[model samples]
Target: MTTPSPSPRLAGHLLVECLIAQGVKDVFGVPGESYLAVLDGFHVHADAIRFVVNRQEGGAAYMAEAVGKLTGKPGVCFVTRGPGATNASIGVHTAFQDSTPMVLFVGDVASDTRDREAFQEVDFSAFFGPSTKGMAKRVERIDDAARIPEAVARAFMTAQSGRPGPVVVVLPEDMLTQAVPDALKALPALNPPQAWSDPGSLRSLRQMLLQARQPLVVAGGSGWTPQATSALHRFAENWQLPVANAFRFQDLFDNRHPQYAGDMGLGTDPGLRRRVSEADLLLVIGARMGEATTAGYTLLDVPVPKQTLVHIHVDAAELGRVYQPALSIQASMANAAKSLEGLTAPPDVPWAEWTASAHADYLASLNGAAAAKVCEGTLDMAAIIRTLSETLPPDAVISNGAGNFATWLHRFFQYRSLSQGLKIQLAPTNGAMGYGVPAGIAAALTTGRPVVTLTGDGDFLMNGQELATAVQHGVKTHVVVLLNNSSYGTIRMHQERAYPTHVLASDLRNPDFCALAKAYGYEAEKIEETSGFAPALARAMARRGGTLIELTFDVQALTTRQTLSGIRDAKGH
Candidate 1:
């Protein structure tokens, strides 16, 4: 018996079918005339996959990036050529630096337009080059309609393999519209190949651990599953090592663990910094120890670290790219963690005292006498973060963008753990200013869980229009906007430190954030004092539709560590 041939279909529909076959449930993007056929394809296969319409390309890209970070799969996004691609580049850069897997599809001018620079045309490959310094890991254009499945499969693989990052695929408009007769089906969903730790390397690491009097474990980077995190927990507990999460990835280890050292990132605890610098052995796992995590590379010596660094990373290229390690293991997080946990430890290691003291420092950084002084304002940001940390569910997801305001969230909120089976924190290690709102919306829509987006007035306005997208999708995300009437709070803080007492372009003539949120069909209120926050938070959480809480604070509440006056006074102006 002869098998029946597949009927001819538009290449766009074939592309959508390929995506569905690859297990994509949701895609985020803004509509464009260039991809109308692809949009119609989404309508035809609406039951198989849902296309989430976003307010702008940037928000759409950020939402996709969030999905990548949350799900461990390649998050998908679509946008038009030229301006749309440029606008979405920020999220691509974020994904690259954050090491999250993401795929961005750019609908381009018709095939006939070629290289004549047609309307809204862009050389995507040139724009998003694949290199050590580029935005994407891979960039390709599909000129033939029949190769959609191949291009898409390759894109997904390239995004997720080794060190995860963003990939871009360019689809010409005319090629998408062309009908093709083919029986092509998507390749089976790809799983990244796991590289296990070498037995000799593990033995070497154990020897290093045995020789050290003081040791620290820095754990973070992408390609981690709940299983990996659990294995990491077991390994840390077995060795009695203090584990410090890298940069914005604070949830990789439970903050409540007895041996949990404070996070290593911006606004890191001073005691923890001292502890890291003083440690004799550094068992660095997964983390690349970028500028933020390494405190602008001042924490460790460049090229060759002063400490005995045993670095393990999935990608061999990253193992010795920044700092030369005494021993390097090229292994996936899961495999390395599993292997490490199997090593038998001595009844009592030498670092028990060191680990306990590290945990003590973490506790002191939280609220003990060693913690920084409280912000001077009616609406105390630190206290508010403490309330959020206490009131929210253990699984509640928190997201924030770049600002001095984010320092409060990072310093005060204690992240539970990814091993708890949820990714609780979504912030950009790249320090992008407009990531929180869209990321929170995506988290709520995808996970069906409570999400709180903390944003400064300037950060909120960058992608605040995405609030409408959340309302349209019936997502329950609470947004907290910290209003200080300054558009560039972080820049202003730096300015005060450098050129004391001179305020330049950082000040903002702002609008009523509550009214703006109300315009987006949300229940909104303004809270001026600390006394009004709890009740307002309860009301927001109880509402059916989403709500926005605008908290007002003075400029004196500059950061967790210092006030505006304090910064200028230090400069002695």
Candidate 2:
């Protein structure tokens, strides 16, 4: 009898093989000693896949999250245990909230040192437990190196299925060193079938549409395929329905379409809000009707809405989780939109005038008298944003973090269409500051598309160090930093509305951003006036290694409509 010789390949190498089998091309991470085997695997398979080195774990996570948004598949990220996992939690939370698919691999301490409180030992399962408010959808640790394929494949599957969220996989350092046999091949990822709309429910929806005088469609959410978007447009055009995007999912709908009603998010258009209230039928296609979308649940309260509610979603668990719908249809967005497109629209919907009014309000709200005047200051933000709209290409990516400075961009910019087959917006629904800089770099590096990032001073500084990552990656994003020296603009607005002039720790002493950006190898410029933006923007687009155009905003230019003094004077009467 002959003894078989053992084939040698590290478990970490097997994990990388599994990722390649699953069609992952790029991964983002910060290097760690615990994951040295995986890094070695990356080195071995360098040509097949690329590992994006990030400055910090948080930025890496954010980059992965943004990649998840750009590409429907789960965004892959690798980080070491304990502190690394803690830092990466922010992106996981954002992915959970935004319904984006992402998989985070945490390299952990050795198996023998688990209970003893070894170096950087922390219970990952306990920390990233699954719950409604939890960080990840699933959290599991792989103790056996042989099961690496099974574990990673499961993570990918769980991350992408149903509601689509983050999954955490813990890898023991000692397990990575174990040699696996060459016969052990990596298994391919399994994707679950999309839930199709019930024919009866869709028919019921059509009947409801026929009966309504004023009907509105709130279109949003992740995983909107091209077929789905086209189907949505056809459905909207067929019935002459007004479609408003949910929260930050503006790119899901064609914003330039006549049927576009406007984005229903923070600072909801007053007229649009009123029209939403006045509507007879609310066909919420993919939107979760989240807090911000429903104006803190005041616009459309749970159990039942003022109008007939047709709630359609991929996840059955999410149907009655919040608002009980008049008719609940369990279906993936593409299937539902495709089914709806198949339905015959009546020759006259009777509410054509009502629909037109809603869209009119949307068009009027953008460049109209009210909107233009709202951005009142020495440096007209509305003019600057509008200039950006005119200057940038339709396919150019626009990303922003949380800020009052974004209000002007939100109000004034008119998104063209997803029909162009490109993701045009990358704003955060979870209200994470410093998301823009990292997201922009990721987008630019990954897509090679022109990227523009809009950020306030406070927001930009959060992960602004990632600008080094951008420069290192040979990607240039036209960065617009609104220099409003403030930590809590949104909080200040609420405080003023509640307690008048009782300001508390909102003001900030910022650095010379222009000089800092220049030091970081960026073509930096400081612009205070509206006219200066065009030239700066043009130069940024033309330049090679990226540019940071700083807008010198006055501290008094608080909100879009009012100054700090005006807000104090009002005392929120």
Candidate 3:
């Protein structure tokens, strides 16, 4: 009746074709038998897309998340079901809270054995259910070989859609080997849908700005390109507003700019917090104003802020999800920034003095305005951060995992503008530990730029094995590990306040990190004082391979502002 169907092709090979069609250059994951066909497909199309083998599922997922932050597309990661999927959930949660676009492919058990709960079988949808409290934005399973194109396309689109986040696609082991019609093809690459601010909303935003005597712009969140960041710079410059980046999104604005008002997060400047609370108008662009950025919801009143809020975000659902704003504009960050840049500013603004004062506060905070309260040992963290700020290239990619150790980096290291080249900061807003090493490796691999990761002794070990991935890939990344021989420094800081001198489960018996790095084929050194750090860093920067520098400090150096006992005394403990 009809011409014979073209020779069938393995669904795994077709899946790789779909990814290649979507312009994916690399896939990060661990090899597993459940997805052996997909692994073979990767080999078949190795020239089109490189498969990066990671030491663990979490590291693989983190690397994918970092790639998503850097590229504004869905960074893809593959893992087998059950433990692999559960292990990869950390990165998914990080991506969700950080608003980074990512796609995690979980190879599930064969369709026949799925409900039986066979070995390594898992129901991914329930595990990664999407909700305000859940980890992923969407979860789906591809049960048919012919529908691979549709599933893959939708997954990518869902990940990059409004309020970008991670999407989970479960692939059955049997489906990967199924033969599909050779004629079937992948859908074209999809671009993130851009929602533009309407003229009326833009007018309202302008009117609000005009009426305000003191206004502050909080900029941060994912989906920012160089062009968008440049537009944001122009918008800030045009209005002469003092801009404070939200939480971990420090590189969104050039910290060197006079209008830079510092970062808003843990260890926030007291002056900046005062300004946020006192500002007549809060023009929040891209930032969700989450608990961390709002100092656990203490800075800004919940449900309804005291300040006249003009909240512009990409997703409509996020507008009134927490604080009801005076004006809410649902538009992509790129479009919103572009529209704001187009809006003309008056010749003289009343908040000029206010803006100047905010910037001055930021500068003073940078100079250790509160350093007198804290006592340090052999090494000074602030000084080390300052050295990094001065030595690294303007476009160097800096990343860190969660820890009190990051406070120094956040406070002292000034980030260059993203317009310089790429997203320079890769810290997770979700406060995920063990994120820095894999993120740094991903940045170095994707951007081919100088990469530096800052981590604490505990944070580094979370995904420190990823160092092997970096060494195997021959990517250059300098890792600075703060050796205090403790895990949960942040928790310990709180413990000292809540229960003084009763530390338990926080102290760590750490290994010789220097020796571990050497074993991983990396140049390693241990620096006990501030002086040795600069020389070691210089040598690391000059080297051809990866490097790890360990800096030991006293436990009293808990945070950038206060010593460990200082917290205890404040609690009268």
Candidate 4:
């Protein structure tokens, strides 16, 4: 008697189960016509994968980035073909530049519909080629479904490997409907090679650092794991090296540490720039050295006497892509840091003198005109940041949406604890706005940790509708909305600087965000005075679920703790 064949549906179900085994719990996407089959599969396995439906494909991608940043895992975003895929590109690019691990799954038209001008047909691979680490299209045969697990493994491997980036997997409509045998469930997850730094490269890098009278280390991206961060701090401490975090990575180094220099961004401390330029050797690890991170890529042009640049990155393409490096080593940032630690003996240098000077400068800068600018108003950005820093639990995770508000957070906020338990997560580098709420939601849901997401009016409105998602999932997040009543405060700052009399497209009138949050079933409060801020935050945090605290401040009060050189440049200064 012939044996009965196993159901293909079960095979498809198992394929999804394998994904769960890989530790992917959160997915972002807006359901589309072409993705119904996968949606059905997802619904069948809803217990394993928690899908967060976003209002837009771009929003979904940003949400995925948020998850990646918070969990240090590959966040997944699903979308349909053509327009859906196109809309998701912004977030993918953000993930790529920021070195965030993410997977973008786009549903494709059926294989038969190729070149038929079918509904939602597009060259998805070509579209995602520039922004992703790897791309693949779906195959229909049951045996082809075997590749799904391997593909996902490879995608995640590439995403977290060299320089973390986004990966795209295009699924054809038929592939989701196709079934595989139950026996095919034993496929193993693909394990990518862990490429270590060569001894010679590590020796050379060490020699360069040792020989230089003034050496500096710059950290960026999400490549620095907890172990790596500890190793880095130890290395810096032992060798008496000064370290500066790129952009929002200040938490990577203890702000109270003597060797810690302020971050590099629009509001970068002038003293930090001076120290960076004075360094004889510049060691950049895991950082892309992107335009924004490098002050429009002009920081490299600063004259450094006897400058020797050593860049360690996972992605070979990023080694010398921005500022030309004297030595570029392609290896995992963690592995490279480990190798460097083994190779370099601690130097006998008075690092305290340099750090003390730098710290003094940073403190003076904070107390100077910048501080005055931040504290002029009753409800200033600096005060809010200080209050939050003082009030929040030491281990509370803070997520900020990209905007003028983030600039303030980056400059003023300091993480005191070096323990992994008190760390923070922000957008890698792409500085994508509208990710704060979703990321806070993911963090709260994944860890049951208290989360606060700070966003500006423009950014909140971008993906504000996701409030419903938070309420649906029972994730409690305290959202602090900075009501600036402007579309782009940074741009307006520039426009005002350039043409003060010319009222450009900078003004914006927005709806009452607190009322809107209440309408969406969140406990919402509007904060118009300083006295109400703490009570509102306390009430919001007391809630078992999501809450929105809308804080209205003078539009002119929106200023970054960092200097706004972008506006200066825009004004032809």
Taking every candidate in turn, the Cα RMSD to the unseen true structure, in Å, is 1.7, 1.7, 1.5, 3.5
In the predicted model 4, the residue pairs found to clash are 98-429, 162-314, 267-562, 267-563
- Pairs with steric clashes in candidate 1: none
Better of 1 and 4 by TM-score: 1
Residues 273-380 of candidate 3 have per-residue lDDT tens digits of 999989999999999989999999899888889999989999998899899999999999889889999998999899999989999999899875455345345487
Candidate 4: tens digits of C-alpha lDDT, residues 149-229: 666667777676656667787777777667667666534444445567777887788778667777788887676667777
- Candidate 1: regions farther than 4 A off: 1-6, 368-374, 481-485
- Per-residue C-alpha lDDT of model 2 across residues 490-557, encoded as one tens digit per residue: 77777787877777877778898888887777779988777888998898888776889888776666
* Superior candidate under TM-score, 3 versus 4: 3
lDDT top scorer = 3
Q: Let me know the TM-score candidate 2 reaches against the reference structure.
A: 0.97
Sort the candidates on TM-score, descending order. 3, 1, 2, 4
Ranked by lDDT, top first: 3, 1, 2, 4
TM-score of each candidate structure, all chains considered together? 0.97, 0.97, 0.98, 0.90
Residue-level error in angstroms, candidate 2, position 255: 1.6
